[model samples]
Target: MKRTTIIALMMLFGISFSKAQTSPTAEDKIHSFVSIKNPPTFPGGMAAFYKFLGENIKYPEQAKKENIQGTVFVSFVIEKDGSVSNVKTVRGLGAGTDQEAERVLGLSPNWVAGTLDGKPVRVKYNIPIKFANKTAK
Candidate 1:
């Protein structure tokens, strides 16, 4: 009985230890631009980045018809591998503009990952995408 109890306790302890090892801790969730030494950037500089957005982003038909015009603020995480994820709209305009902004960011290419202490790390990034419609005079 004593040997059996000891074995059971050992198994329980081993399972708990493995669980702890696999679970993410507070430190593991520490991806933020505030703590990073350098923030992520697109392949080119801001000028080129804005040009890319203008070219790739499509004005939603509904938004265009409704004459919706405003800037959509998007927030996303740039991973250590330079891939983007967790895209969300912090501020949005109606008439499908919010969805369009998210779509454009989703289709963006991998950026230069942010760095912390010169080591590549995930960082949070925010950008404002503008939508405007011009009618003939």
Candidate 2:
């Protein structure tokens, strides 16, 4: 009787441990962007997108003059249709840096949407923007 009770308790604990180790289902892990439908292609790839940012982003003169420098982390949802939406700054520095990061992300042309199980899926991407002061020789 003692051995049987010990075995039963061990089985119960094992079952509970197994349950805790189970991963969440795909549906449960889906992000909000997955529910919204979007377009199929972005105008350019990553290289071109970066080029756009370099060309368009204006480093704040005041910040640069003061030698303020930091990285801004921007988060956005890439829709299944290749369109980027819900642009926001996850990490930021003051001195007009975060706004510039948001502006650049918002202006980005679509991107190649990510896929899961051979179907387009919304994915979250984080972009880091850096600002540095340029010194005159």
Q: Say which candidate scores most in TM-score.
A: 1
**lDDT of all predictions, in order shown?**
0.84, 0.74
What overall lDDT, based on C-alpha atoms, would model 1 receive against the true structure? 0.84
* Model 1 bad stretches (over 4 Å): 1-27
Q: Model 1: per-residue lDDT, tens digit, 1-137?
A: 99999999999999999998999864346376776668888899768878988998888899878888989999988888888899999999979999988888888899998777777877887789988887612
lDDT of 2 by residue, 7-109 (tens): 9999999999998889765643435433435423345665677788889889877677667787888888777676777789999887888888898788877
Candidate 2 C-alpha error for residue 58, in Å = 0.7
Off by over 4 Å in 2: 1-44
Determine which window of 10 residues in candidate 2 has minimal summed lDDT.
32-41
lDDT of 1 at 128: 90
